[model samples]
Each structure stands twice: as C-alpha cells, then as structure tokens.
Target: MSAVMISRKVRKWEKLPGKNTFCCDGRVMMARQKGVFYLTLFLIIGTCALFFGFECPYLAVHLSAAIPVFAAVLFLFVMAMLLRTSFSDPGVLPRALPEEATFIEMEIEAANGNVPSGQRPPPRIRNIEINNQIVKLKYCYTCKIFRPPRASHCSICDNCVDRFDHHCPWVGNCVGKRNYRYFYLFTLSLSLLTIYIFTFDIVHVVMRSVEDGFLSALKETPGTVLEVLVCFFTLWSVVGLTGFHTYLISLNQTTNEDIKGSWSGKNRVQNPYSHKNIFKNCCEVLCGPAYPSVLDRRGLMHEDSPVSASSAAPSSSSSSLSFSNNSKPAPPTTKTTAPLIPNEHTPDDAKASIGVSAEQSCSPEDLPPSFIPPLASPETDAEASVAKDNSH
Candidate 1:
C-alpha cells in the first residue's frame, strides 16, 4: 500500500494573541467572545447582589424569589458553556479537499538550507465535476484535486478546510460543515436565555416598586437595586447579540460569509440569491430542507433553482462545479476526504523527472518555470567535458 500523508498536528482548543498556542485554525471567535460575555455577566450579577443587601435592611420576604432567579440564570450560564464546548469541537461533517490545493507559497528563510533563489508559485489548479456541477477549486501541489465547497487553505492548519468556518480558539476547534447546527443552536439558546433573564429582572423591579411603595421603595426594598443590575446586563447581551444574528439571518449568511462576502454577488451582474422577501429566504435557511438550506447558497447560487443547464452559468473551470442542478433535492455529499498526494518515487513521477517520458495531459515542456532546472552555461559544460577526457 502507498504511504498516505495525513495531518500530523494536534487540533487546537485555545489561542493567545500572537501565539500559535491553540488551534491556530482560521475559524470564528465564538468560544472566546462567549467567555468574555459570561465573565461580565458574573461580575454584574455579583455587584447587584451585593448592593441589594446593603440597601434593604430587611430582605427576608423576597429572599426566596432571589434564590430561584439566581438559580435559573446560573443554569443557563452553565448550559451555554457546555453547549459551546460540544459545538466547537470536531464537527460531524468532515472536511474534504484535494491534497494539492493546500500547497501555498511559503516564505522560507535562507537559514533553512541551500535552495533556489526565485520564489515558487502555487500549482495550476484544475476544476473537476462532482455529481455534475462545475466547481472552481485549487489543486494542492502536495495533496492533489477538488476540495469541498467553502474549503479553504488554512495557513496554520497547513491544510484545506471543507466548507471552512472560522477556526475558534476557545474550543480549539474548526467550525466546518458538521458542527454548524450545534453552533447555531448554542447562539439561539444563549440569546433566549439573555432575553429571559432581562424580562424577569425588569418585572421584579416593578414588583418591588408596587409592594414597598414607590415613594420609599429605594429604602424599603434594596433587592430592587440588584434586579436593575441584572436587567441591564441581560438586556445589553440580548440586544447586541440578537441584532447581529438577525441581520445574518435576514441575508441567510454566516459570519465568515459576511466577512468574505462570498455570497454577496458583488462582482456578478445579477444577484441570483437575492430573494423577494427576506423572510422567505430566512424561513428556508432555518426551517426548510436543502443542501445549502438557503443560507449556505445565498451568496453562491441563485435561489429558485436554475431553469436549465444554460441558465446557470457554467463554472469558469472544472474545479468549481457544484453538480448540474442546485434544486434537485439531493442530499448533501457524503464523501468528505481530501485527495492524496502521489508518491515522489512512484514510476509516474520518475518517468517525468529524467525527461524519459511524460504523463498523459501533463507535458514536461509546458511545466511552470519553477519546476524547470537552471540551464548550464557554456564554460561549465566545457570544463565538464575536459574533466571526463582527463579521467579516461
């Protein structure tokens, strides 16, 4: 059996600024951001509790209410953290890309070793037909073939990611095609929890005002102060998070997609994914059934499905194919593995190396400049010929 080149690095779980300590995977910052938010919430909650005890000399009556509210908030916090952990780990949908696509231009220092002076360019990528669609893709010089959609060459991971989401440091994981659902659910639940806490605290403030008499409520019920504190924190979290997510939902986009504008249809003459109603697009993404599920393909493909083969523009190259029909109601691709690199010592490469023979479709003369050897000068050739005569 041929020796296959598998990734040898450990998957990351955390990252520090300027340090390659964690995954170093180029995914999102959900886990890290959530940590900061959780910390702020804890401090706010503590401060409110402390202030409430100070103001209200008699807290006996409402102490029971405080216990349950606090418990619920704590539960939500723990649940969110746990959910984040599972979601950020290796996702269910595995990554798939051609081995050759991962070979990028590297800046090697002179200290490394003696080498050629000029820079090496990435190999010419080729498009391939998967299912039937033409997909544009890069050919990994080392690995080889078409990678999965959204798959990207991660400089840190030193490989390509299929449906690449951002690398998350907090969980030391890559958010790819598989764990997307968990990631989305975690956000949704956290948002709901924030809103829930905000509502209760606000209501508690009103209740305190009524029972203790609004005129002297400040002194009569000090716990009301704590309620207000929780209210602000929860409200802020809900508003900020919900607003950001709402916009993403409306466009059926992801944080990465938003950043990259992969689905913006910016360069294209017409935005195929642009929908008549935002809700219609959102509904399909969140509740409808589809490979792209509306959200995935929003910026990439037209929504209502291409009318015919000619209607959908053919991919510029074979690497960009996406099967012929986007609306075929087909299941997502199950084959999710990167292509393998060919052995250097194999007969195929050996034959091409010595100019003895050429591989099919790959002419040696047409190889890129970097792959060609430097020409020998006339003076060096004459010396070599004289040395051979002397030896004889």
Candidate 2:
C-alpha cells in the first residue's frame, strides 16, 4: 500500500506560539489577557439594559417611539463594531524562518562587512523611501526580521503587528491594519450611544417632573438616576476618544505615530502614509478596501506537508537551488530542536564539506546572493577561493 498513509492534520492556530487566545476552534482570536475586554462588555451591556428598561418605555409612550428605535439601532451597531474589532486578526507578520533569517544576516554582513575587534557593530536599521520621503525600518530581534513600514512589535501580544495603532485592552486585541476601521467605528458609535442615552434620561426626568416635581420623580424611578450618572461620567471620555480618533483619521495617522510625534513637523520625517488631503485621508481610512489577515491562522497542515518533508530531507538551505525552491512558503527549520545559528557548522555540513571536490563546489560569484554566507571561518574562505578558481 506504498508505505501506509499516515494522516494527522493540525490547525495553524493550535500549533502557533503567538501570545493570543483562540476560540471557536480558531474563528475568534484575541489577546490572552482579556480581563479588560470583559469589563468593557459589562459597562456597555449594563448601560444599555438600564436605558432600555427604565427610560425607553416612558419615552416611547409619552415622547416619539423613534427615540427608543434610534437608541436600539445605535446599541446594536456599537456591539457589532466592538465584536468585530475584538475578535479579528490585527495584521500580524509571521516570524522569519531559519533559512530566511540566515539569508538576511548574510546579506547584512556582506553589505556592511566586518568591524574591528574593539569596535561595536552598527544598529540594524535600513532606510527606505516612501513618497519621496525617507523612512527607517528598524530590525526587530524578536520577530527576526526588519519590520516593514508602519509595523511595530507589541510587547503585550509578543507579536509584530503591521501598521500597528495601539494595544487596546478594552477590545483585547492590538489595533492594527486589518481591524483599525472597525475599532474607529466602535469608538464613534459608542460615544453617540452614551450621548443619546444621557439626553433621553434627562428628557424623561423633566417630563415626570412636570407631573410630580423633580425630587419626587427621582424617587419614583431610580434607574434614570443610575443611567444619568453612568452616561454623565462616561460621556467626556467616550466623546474625547471619538474626537481624538477622528483627528487621527483626518491625518491618516495612528495613535502610536501621534505619541511618537512622527509627523508633528518638528522632525525631519513627516507622515509618508498620508495623501496630503484631509478628505482623501478620511476616505482612505474609513472607506478603503479592507486588508486581509496574513497570519494564515486557519491553514491546515497535514503530516506530509512541505514543512515536514523539508525536515526529513538532506539540508540544502545553504545552496542556491534550495533557496529558489523555498521562495514560495517558509520552511519549518526554525521549529527544529537544535539551536539555529546561520553559520553554525553541523556534522552534515562538515561531512559534505569534506566529501565534495573543490572542482565541483560552486562559487559564491556564480550563485545568487540569497545563499551567500558571511566570511566567518578560514575553511569557508578557502572553499570560496577554490570555487572561484573553478568558475573562472
């Protein structure tokens, strides 16, 4: 039967080491620390229950029925936006594979060469131009890659989020490229809900006061007092947050950028992500096409996947052919039990190095830069020279 077929499939999210919680078998994702998210729910649902129970009935009969209808719509919208922001992937970038990391380190060393024994190496920062403006991409040692433009590593989540806005405990997810729109809408609608509830509670109190004075009306319906206090206290913070986010949206900026004063005009690097038009910026942020999550958390991996096959086969990561073959999907070498040092000499490397004839060995000059290693050892240097002579 061609060596009995072994079938064992695992979900990507289950095997991931990311500091996130998975629910519904991987459909709902959130930060592991979800205490604040529950508090946010309690506050929202509690306020809604109070308003609908106490004020909505009185307002509907005496005042226009549209008042309760509008409140209900706002409440539902706020809940939907909150859930969307809380449960969605925030555009997390995958960690670099061992081979990919080795390639990057080799390229960095090739470009910058080596420093003196007493001298310190320069920081791994690369400058890239965006919209005629220069932006520096800093290397994140945690993620083992130079973070892309607008990407930042969140300490709380222990993940590099693309276009990271902020780690919002209230929503239990990092506000980032994928779910920023929903987060913005949540804050905007929540502020309106607070204002609507507060205004109607006062209107209900005044109508009751006309019949039985203000003090007696307050005594009769205690829920209005609770609703007023909750809304009154929450009003400023909610409205202020909405306004602040609106300002950020207008500038096409994030809370992270604003805090860092990235585009405050005081620094040389202005916000390159902006289009320089307020209307366009607002539309781009609010109405732009949604970005799909790149984490691939739901991808199925069977026992015989490329990831497993790559491990069982002979190591060819240091060769040109292997690099070209692995250009599609990242290899699973990073997950190996052995420590991964790009230039570390394995027993296999030593054996191959001795068995292969100098004439058969390919030169670094003939191969693409993808598999080139740093000049770390004299043996490697001698091998390179021998390969170069053969190529010539």
Candidate 3:
C-alpha cells in the first residue's frame, strides 16, 4: 500500500482565504471551527446506534416492524441532509478585484469631495429599490465591495454570503441561500428521528417492565436509558429549530433579516423578497431550484500570483486604466556609484602617546663667554676691564 500510494494534488480551494476547512482535495468543505459539530455527530450516531443495536430488535420482535423501518429511513434522511448542509457551499461571493475595488473607491471619493478635515466619513452604504422597497447595501471592507441585497459578511467565516442566514455550529456551516433548504430538512428529519427513538425507547422499557418488572427491565436493557436521555434532550432543540425555520420559510425571510427586524420595525419595512402568498413563499424557499456554487472550489486556479492581483492598480480611477500600457515592460535605467577614499590629512591626535622621551637641560656655565650670563663670568669680566684701563 505504501509503494502504491499517490501524492495529493493541490487545488484552487487550497489557496482560498475564507475561514473554511477543505478536505479530500476540496471535495468536502466545512467551517474552520467545528468542535461543536463533532459533538453533534457523536450524539446522533451514538443514540441511533444504541437504539438499533439494543432496542430495535426487541421492539421489532415483540411490538411492530414498522417502528424500526421508519426509524432507519428517517435516520438515513437526517444524516444525508446533515452532510449535504455541512459540506455544500453557502453561496459565498468572491472578493472584488483590486481594479474594481479601486474604481469603487474612486467613485466614493468623487461623491464625497472636499470633506472637512478631522471629521468622520459617513458610512459606506448604497440604497437600491427592490419591489417598491428600499434596500440598503453596506460596504464590506474585507471583500472590497458593497454587498448585494440579502447578502452579508459572516465575521466567523470571513466571507460575504448571498441570502445570508446565521451560521450554525451544530451543522458546522453558514446557513445561506445555497444550503438553507438542506439545513431545514436536516433539522426537520432529525427532530422526527429523535422523537421516534424517544417514544420507542420508553415503550420498550414499559413492555419489559410489564413482563419482568420495571427495575429488572432497566437492568437488562441499560442502553435504553442512555438512548432515552440523548433523544429527550435533542428533541426540543431540533423541533424548535424546525418550527422556527418553517415560519421563516413561510415568510420568505432569512434568519439574518428576521433578527435585524428587516421587515418588522418602527420603519415598518415590508419584505421585498416575499411572494405575498404563503404557499408560494414556502414553495419558493423549499422547492426552488438550488443555486450552483460560485466559488468553484475544485476548479483550477488562474496561473498568477496573488501579489499580482493589486500591485498595478492606480490610486484613483482604476476602471479607466489602459490594459495595453500595463502589459508593456518599462525601459530600465543604469546608474554609476563612485568608490569612497579615506582622507589622508585628518589629524592623528585622536590617539594618545604611549611613552614620552626625556628632554636634555643645558647649563649656563657650558655656554661661551659672550653667550653666558653676566653673573657667571663676573671675575673674568673685571680682569678684562682693568687691562683695558691701563692701555687707555
């Protein structure tokens, strides 16, 4: 097996900056942080395993076969929807190109010309009319574009998602237009599965209690207690989630819109996306055509470095840039540099003399008479003066 192994190939999703973990060469994608998701998987698998392994056989033989059959089908559906919701793309929008970003920036600057110094700039928002309703689009600095209507940035995922809904930790994915249907189905099926398991576990225990006494029944089938506990706890959350999502589907609103009071507020803004008919809205939300993933996680990336994306974009008016000029290489300029020479005339007094030689002192008596002091040659001078007087 080691000798027959093949190296994994790098794909486009490997270079993506979004906060998602890609596995199996970009085929499986999920949130980067999925600690809760693992627990969710464990509980689901553990409870179902306990039910099928311990309680299902007894219930099928003694009670009814349809219980196990319906349970298995519901469990399979739940798991399928869970994986589909977790692994599928959540309608993530690609980041704007540097040129596009710069063009937008230039437009913003042009619109807001000559702003006073030391004043805060107004929020970057664009309002567009949708079905007679004004929808505000906010700028996403990270993605470098104004988000589309019903689209928003997920701080956890660090990606702008279309028809954005809240991120679900249990599913380990952001619930958005692409995967919300799967998520809704997952919650619905899971709730049904939990309720079924809980109901049967109690019934199985009661049957044992009737035949072998209640205490003895619990002792013989200890797994029933665990399964019951698991299902009982999970049942409420899944059911509540299912109902809440059902309401949202009917209204044709996202979790984000509902939370932000996009429709119900003091402003009394109506939902622009709604079809006005409850049946139509439900059908549109749950039965509409699924949108394709735009990120193209498995597609080959363009053979260009990421640094090249924004390097050539001008400071302003980037949309009007000439691609032909940008493609041409600029002429190179040559430069000459003179070598440095040390100064020879600089003073050498910076260094102290290690040792000094002693100077000789000459005595006055060793000098010639004319050069001598008068006191040293006093006697000789008197004798010469007497001889001169006799000659006169």
- Candidate 3 lowest-lDDT run of ten: 351-360
Question: Tens digit of lDDT per residue, candidate 2, span 246-287?
Answer: 999999999999998888856667788899899999999989
Local accuracy by lDDT, each model: 0.48, 0.86, 0.83
Q: Tell me the deviation in Å of residue 104 in model 3.
A: 1.2
Return the top candidate by lDDT: 2
Please report, as a residue range, the 10-residue window in candidate 2 with the lowest summed lDDT.
304-313
Stretches > 4 Å off in candidate 2: 1-7, 302-392
TM-score of each: 0.42, 0.75, 0.75
- Clash statistics: count for each candidate: 33, 0, 0
User: Given candidate 3, what's the lDDT at residue 77?
Assistant: 93
What is the Cα root-mean-square deviation between model 3 and the actual structure? 17.9
Runs of candidate 1 with Cα error greater than 4 angstroms are 1-124, 128-135, 139-146, 153-161, 167-174, 213-227, 230-234, 269-392
What lDDT score is found at residue 310 in candidate 3?
44
Model 1 deviation from the true structure expressed as Cα RMSD, one decimal place: 26.4
- Residues 245-335, candidate 3, lDDT per residue (tens digit)? 9999999999998898989988997889998899999899889998988887898754432223244444322432333235444579888
